[model samples]
Target chain A: MDSIDKKLLNIMQKDFPLSSTPYKDLGEMLGISEEDVINRLGKYKKEGLIRKIGGIFNPRSLGYKSTLVALEVKEGKLEDTASFINRYQEVTHNYQRDHTFNLWFTLIAPSRERIKEIIDSVERLPGVRKCMNLPSVKMFKIGAYFSLDEEGEREEQKSDQ
Target chain B: MISDRDKKIIKHLQEDLPLDSRPFKNIAEKVGMEERELLKRIEEMKEEGMLRRLGAVVHHYQAGFAYNAMGCWRVPQEMIDEAGKKMSCYREVSHVYQRPSHPPHWPYNLFTMIHGHSREDCEGIAESMAEETGISEYTLIYSLREFKKTSMKYF
Candidate 1:
């Protein structure tokens, strides 16, 4: 990707405009046409440079009670336990770590009772030995944007902004 | 450059972008605003760092780049910025961040993510990262399956 592409990516990752002619408006700013913007974005997606380009909202804002859950399963059942936990739509991301409590995932439910219900269901799965949930006490979230082009004092730049 | 009206325009846009030929006109009609007004608000948001371009959100596995793993490194508190900066440079590294590590419970300090076509591809990135950081003890947590990918709603 070129400098322009990198800039486009950096901007898009944080806040993608929700507009019908967003590309057309974006093209106007970049001195390109809407067709060019569409083509470039298509190419970027094809290249795996971006995971997704859609609405990214705060889960809490949507009234979902979410928490990060960690679990340790017996040997040889990692795959099975992980799949079982992931089968629920409430589980957003599930990963197998190297620690004793190997499996960790985030779960979001419409209510606290529903979350407990789901957690209980996950615990019932065979080979699941232990489970714990750690909800974020406080969020210092910066919304995950890497300014690849900006080479110096990025944190400072953000604070200044 | 963005005002309250611009924010409202985005709130409407998030529901769904019109899929027709005259999408802007369609959006304008729905939002009870003129096309020019809606277009102007979008332009301001872009300038103000509030909105990027609109586009399609792809399903990675559907497209066949399915090997995605979250690799965490145990960087000392002093080296987090250095490690995060280093990890951010790699093209393979998509997401990089620093999360609190509670040892005897949670040991990994720095988190970096890489998505590839296969497990071997992800392993390659992990091995390379190990060599780069000179940290022998780390974790490569691969996703066994994806349950949800929907973005949370703002409104």
Candidate 2:
């Protein structure tokens, strides 16, 4: 990415404009026209540099209880089971790691029962093994700022308003 | 330049905060207000700190910065800020904050997350951190799976 692209990414990652014409407003700040901003962002999207542009919700405020559950899937069926678990909209992130409990994902549910239900759903998936739930008893920190600038300081950000 | 319609706009914007062009226009239609009025309220809310940001919270795994671990440090009260500052500066380190370390109960005084493309990469970052900070007493709790990753809501 060019300097302008990096600068734009930095700005967009933190505080995207919520205005009706955010591109126009952002262009004004960046000393470019609104059309240019849109075209550049469109290119970024096409290049897969930007996965999606949208409001990231604070799940806790929306009344969903979440937890980080870890499990070991049958060695060969990891990918299949991962795809199965990823089907749920509530399954925000899923990944494979190098450890005894290899597969990890985050699950948010409307209630404790729903959390159990989802776990059972995954447990029933082919290539089953062992599972464990490590729910966050306390949250030390959540949102973090990634300032691309080399000299930027790290900020321990509050998750939401 | 505030109006009742603007308040409605602000109310909706505080929720979901769509990722789309002309989001304010979308919100304006929902809140029964003109797009310009909605825009003004958003600008004001951002200025007032009621709205922190509106942007893409990407799927970290897909980005290839996937390897992650919960690192714990027995940070002294006096040096947490110094240590946290050092750890948080690394792009690989995402969340760095202080938590009370209660002995005979909980031992980790400071917690931070490190992300990378592979286990070796994550450990390499951790090793460098240990060397740079001279922090020998640390444990790397690698995440075996990512069960969930979402933000909390503020009512």
- Best lDDT goes to which candidate? 2
Candidate 1 residues lying further than 4 Å off, grouped into runs, are A1-53, A57-68, A73-103, A107-161, B1-11, B44-53
lDDT of 1 by residue, B24-59 (tens): 777778778988877777666555555433444444
- lDDT per residue as tens, model 2, A1-161: 55566567667777676556788888888888887888887776667656566544445544557776667788889878888888787677787866655787888776889899999988877686777665654443456534334333222233332
Cα lDDT for residue B62, candidate 1: 42
Rate residue B42 of model 2 by lDDT: 60
Off by over 4 Å in 2: A124-126, A145-161, B1-21, B34-52, B58-91, B96-111, B116-121, B128-155
Which candidate leads the pack in TM-score?
2
Candidate 1 docking class: incorrect
Error of 2 at B123 (Å): 3.1
TM-score of chain A of 2: 0.84
lDDT by residue (A4-30, candidate 1, tens digit) is: 665565556554444556677667767
Compared with the true structure, what per-residue lDDT tens digits does model 2 show for residues B1-155?
34565446445754654435676788778987688876676666556554455665544543334567877787666777677778766767767766555463346667778776677877898889888877778877775555444443322
Lowest-scoring 10 consecutive residues by lDDT in candidate 2 chain B?
A: B146-155
* lDDT (Cα atoms) of all candidates against the true structure: 0.64, 0.65
Query: Against the true structure, candidate 1 has what lDDT?
Result: 0.64
